[model samples]
Target: MTAIPPLDPPARLLMGPGPISAYPSVLRAMSAPLVGQYDPFMTGAMSDTQELYRQVWATENDATLLVDGTSRAGIEAALVSLVRPGDRVLVPVFGRFGHLLAEIAERALAEVHRIEVEWGQVVPVSLIEEAILRVKPHVLALVQGDTSTTMNQPLDEVGAICERHGVLFYTDATASLGGNPFEADAWGVDAATAGLQKCLGGPSGSAPITLSDRAVEAIRSRKRIEAGIREEGDESASDFVRSNYFDLGMILDYWGPRRLNHHTEATSMLYAARECARVLLAEGRDAVIERHRLSGAAMLAGVEGLGLTVFGDVAHKMHNVVAVEIPDGVPGDAARGALLDDFGIEIGTSFGPLHGRVWRIGTMGYNARKDTVLTTLAALEAVLRRFGASVPAGGGVEAASEVYSGAAG
Candidate 1:
């Protein structure tokens, strides 16, 4: 066997869309020694984590818990458990993540009906309302924020619409949860899922999920215990879900009082997830949202000050990330590479329709600070100027500083 390097990675300022710098406390939590999955301390940590995520999700549901994978894993668990083979699912695709929701539903063998809107914008409430009235889907699965297009879909009215139409409303909050305003209960969301990587200020691994009473009822209808532990005549789902790992019913039992043996819990990730919520709740969620709001505004101002156009509908932009149009004279990928290689800062590249046309700059989680925002803007200005693009020397920094000053005032 060859001897390789021992986990030495360059320290980077991750000012991009997601997986942005993990919170120091979160990383420390992940470093704690492991214990047996069902150890008293371990179960206590899991219970604490569940309670904390309930606060984070702003819900009182008993089903709020953590899934053992990324944000998408939580989404899959909710969908496969809710959508039967022939159930109707309506997905409104406006950006990459929304399309992802639709695709996952399709793979679940849902009778999928999609309502489309152009990228860089959100589907209007009226359109969603119309879709609900017309198709009358069993579930309406949507994404609250799509990093690819840098837009936050307004979920308040849509949730109400789904409720009025007797549809289960689920949202993937992977990209917007902590830094943005998300009212899972107030908005009548039946199920919501998020990851630690984005606004929660942690690495990608644990997924926080919450299920309303209605959603729990829907999932329980398809519940099935594993055959190994099954008693004779034990009731199982009529049409069993295709996946066991993404099975929410079994996961619920594992997290519930039953503590039924499913997969061994990811203890380190559970610790990290708990700490992330602890830090946010300690700082206060409203205060954290205000911080992200200020930082995002600063970055937007800095980019516009550098004579770059902002992409998408500014009115609907997320508080954590911005999509800036790549200047015609500069090579988008080359400039992004320069920023990373020379400055050790990461800015995201766009995807799908906006690919090669825009750079997604993020001010989120632990990085949503005045200094982080200013550093990213300054580095971006330098990279653009180096690439022979016309940019003012101190314009970006000055504008961002002004935003900070105004915010302080």
Candidate 2:
């Protein structure tokens, strides 16, 4: 057998769009001893996690629970559970992830309709209202933030628009939930989903989701009995949720008081998820958001101080990530490599429409700190200078430090 060495990974400072460095407390939580899926302690942990996520999601959803997979898993569970076949789903496409929602809805056999804006700009709430008036979709699915183009779409008004038209509002908050202001109840979102990897300060694997009473009823109407739990005269829906693993109805049954069997729960990931929320809530969601705001502004100033142009509409950009244009004569990926190899700092290269045009720098999760922000800006200046692009000496870090000086909130 071929032998592999002990796990000694490079000491990297993750400064990219997602899967950023996790919180130390969250890591420690994941290392605690495991318990049986249905153990009393395990169930208690599950219930605690549900309540914590209710606070995290800013909702009073009784169906708040964790989907034991990545952010995409939570999204699918919500979409498939709430949308029956032939349901019309409207998605406002501002960036790549919006396209992802439309694709998932299409695969769910829903009649998908999309309203698109330019890649770096947000889709206005008025436009979404106009689309709803025109198409009358059953469910309005939107992305709170799309990291690919660094845009955070405004959902404040869209929710009321959906309510007026009797449409269910579901948003994928994977990239924006912990770092930005997301009021699920105030925004009138019927369903919402997010992951730990981005601003939640934890690793990817578990997806936190919440469903309003209205959204829960949508799933219950189409539930089919589990084979083992079925009685002799039990009736079944003619149509079942297409994917067993991604069905929110059965998942809810597992998470609910019935404690019915589904897949064995991911115990460690559950612990990590719980810890992430506990820390965030203890820190105060508003304060955490303000921290991200300050750090993001500092990063933006630092990048601009280095003579880099910011991409997208800054007025509506997500607070956790920023897109800076690659200068002429610099190879985008090569610069990223230099940052990683030389300075042990990692930033993201763009995808799709923004590919090779811009670099995505993140200030989020555990890495959203004064030191981490300054380090990234400093290292980026070095890399730019190494690539023969002229940059002012000490300007990047200086600008960032200036912002940090007043960032006590």
Candidate 3:
């Protein structure tokens, strides 16, 4: 037998820009004893999870449930199930994630129409509305927050525009779910998907998805199952839907009363997701958003006080993450490595044209606390000073402390 290596306990710190440290309670929930997939208690837990996600997504849709994968899986499941061959789909490309939506639409064999803008800027609702009018697509796909650019797309007016054009609005809220204000039903989001890794304070495995009646109808029309496998007089289903594993029609049945077999449920991930939702709900959705808002603002002020420029317009930035332009003559990788190795802090770098150009600092989930924010700022100032930058000593820490003090008062 091969020898198994003993695992070392993980070092704890606030995680920024993703997989933000999972809550201790959520980790404990995942440690619960495993139960049979069809056990009564397990089924009840499943139902409860769906209920929790409905509250988290702020939706009344009956089809709301957890997809057994990461946030991208939820996006794929929604896109693959909704768009048929040659269907028209409109995507407003603002960042890397916008390209993701376009890619998913292409995989669904949809004729994609894209309206793109500069990376740091968000797509105006009018631009998206104009694209909808021009393409007249059956589905309109967008991302609620693209962490790549640290921008949150304005969603308040998007649903109304889609409604006027008879287009179903779909959004990937993976980076914005717990930290930002989102209302699936109120925003007219026909289908929305998110992950637990960002601001949800849980491990990244399960993907929560909510579907409006309109989205469900579109999926239901294409429902199918394998043929030639039913007993005599069995009302076997059609084979209309493309992929079995990602088919939302079958997934809904499996999650619903039918209890049909799809993929085996990712039990631990479900538990983690449930606890994550429990944490958010217990905090009150608005309060959770407020916490993120304050944390992000503090981080922004601290970075600026250190003689750094924030990349995006402050008026439009997401409340959980911020992008800052790297200082000239400073090697971005070396600076990031110093923070991680020496200070045990990790922030992110960007993609595409932004590679090595900006530092994506995040104040999200478990990392949004005052101490974490202050500590990150302090360490960042130290690192910048080492790189010959003219940052005033203690400037970042002092600026962040003021934000915390003001908020508490």
Q: Return the candidate ranking by lDDT, descending.
A: 2, 1, 3
Q: What is the lDDT of candidate 2?
A: 0.92
After the best TM-score superposition of candidate 3, give how far the Cα of residue 288 lies from its true spot, in angstroms.
0.5
The residue ranges of model 3 lying beyond 4 angstroms of the native Cα positions read: 1-4, 9-14, 227-239
**Candidate 2 lDDT trough over 10 residues, lowest sum:** 230-239
Per-model RMSD to reference: 1.6, 1.7, 2.5
| Highest lDDT scorer | 2
**Which residue pairs collide in model 1, if any?**
none
Which of candidates 2 and 3 reaches a greater TM-score?
A: 2
Better of 1 and 2 by lDDT: 2
C-alpha lDDT of all candidate models, in order: 0.91, 0.92, 0.89
The digit string of per-residue lDDT tens for model 2 on 283-383 reads 99998999899999999999998989999999999999999999999999999999999999999988888999999999998998999999898899999
Question: Model 3: per-residue lDDT, tens digit, 1-409?
Answer: 9998899755746545787888889999999999988999889999999898899989899898999998999999999999987899988888999999999889878899899999889998878887888889999999989999989998998998888889999999999999999999898999999999889988888899999999999998873654424334546343255677899988998899979878789989888998999999999988989999999999999998898989976788999999999999989999998898889888889999999999999888878889999989989988998988889889998988899899999
Estimate the TM-score of every prediction: 0.97, 0.97, 0.96
